[model samples]
Target: MKFRHLRNEKGISLLEAMVAFIIFSFGLIGLAPMFSLSIESNVIARDNSFASNLIKETIEEYQGVGSLPSLPFEETEDILWTKPTLSGESTSSESASRTNIFSRTISLEDNSTDASIPNGVVQINVNISWLNLYNKQKNLSSTSYLIES
Candidate 1:
């Protein structure tokens, strides 16, 4: 009697398994574009970080000088950055080289003439621009104040 009952019971057929597999594959295929998007976002974020750092360093360099730069001054230059290897070691011959060039502009403004601003105060503006991985133009800007001692 038990054997007869067991024979009446049915298991999942091969066709059902194949259908489930197809459904799962379609789901994975839908997610394929997300991987590329994530990588692109990461590259953009890295470039932005580098640009911000360059602006910060330029501001600090000007601030640390013994004499303040002349007001209404403007200068632009190209910045070169080299990518570091994954091993964190420098090899002269076996180095993999990747370089990025960023354009930076610095301008100074005299704010002492304005009644709202205190005397002997200068405004510093720094702008950094770069072409992203997608060949798109992106830029960042920063402003700071310097007081004459």
Candidate 2:
């Protein structure tokens, strides 16, 4: 009696299985573009993070030098930052192949002109600009105040 009942049960036909497969494939196809978008977003985020860190490090270096040159100074230069390979080796070829060269600008201004600030205060500005994976220019800036003891 149990065998007869099991035989009577209806299973999904080939048509139903094919329809389900088609639906799943379409869903995957719809999600394909999102993968590329996600990768692009990640690259942009990474570049932004690197640029921000560069600005911070440059500012800190300037502040570490207890004394700075005459105020109202401005300088700009192109910086090539390189990273080591998996073997912890950095070669000229690797550096040259990298497209992360950034343009940096460092400026210092005497803050004494501002009536709201004291006479011994100085303003430091560091700006970093770079091109992202898409060849779009992006910029980051940091400002700091230093006081003469």
Candidate 3:
């Protein structure tokens, strides 16, 4: 009988390693956008929540004073805690209104279908705008109603 010696190959082939790397890269590429979208959604939600709190606090303050504070109020002004601070020069709106208001009011004027609703209804709008990490301007607005009973 002739003695035969067999040599075993151990370790991945170059072609196999390359194929694995390519597959992994494809998966990462597919997953990257999903991760990005999730992060953006979280950021928007957080901003909206912060804005909502601001609006709610302002509303509560107005209720206590029984009048809405003007657009700008000094820190030493009465009911200063309820005042809304306009941030960023670019977001300032030029819309003007002449209500001849006997009392200070920051409530929204509802012009949509006023068919017998509750009295003394004030609209609360939470507006939040931010410059995202991607250098894009993002804004969100949420509306709610509050009536002093």
Model number with the top lDDT: 1
In model 3, where is the ten-residue run with the lowest total lDDT? 96-105
- Model 2, position 131, has a per-residue lDDT of 80
lDDT of 3 by residue, 38-124 (tens): 987986565455555655665566557666444222221112122233565332453222111111123353323343435566555
| Predictions in order: lDDT | 0.84, 0.81, 0.51
Error of 2 at 89 (Å): 14
Give a tens-digit lDDT track for model 1, residues 1-149: 35553554478878999999999999999999999999889878888999999999998998899887566688999988776666766657554246678999998777644456567887888999988886788899999988877
The residue pairs found clashing in candidate 3 are 68-104
RMSD of 2: 4.6
User: Considering TM-score, which of the candidate structures 1 and 2 is the better prediction for this target?
Assistant: 2
Residue lDDT tens for model 2, 25-47: 99999999999999889878877
Order of candidates by TM-score, top first? 2, 1, 3
Clash tally, candidates in order? 0, 0, 1
lDDT of 2: 0.81
Task: Give every collision pair in model 2.
Answer: none
TM-score of candidate 1 against the unseen true structure: 0.77
The true-structure Cα RMSD of candidate 1 reads 4.3
Candidate 3, superposed: residue stretches over 4 Å from native: 1-6, 9-11, 66-105, 108-149
Model 2 residue 2 lDDT?
A: 55
TM for candidate 2 is 0.78
20, model 3: CA deviation in Å? 1.2
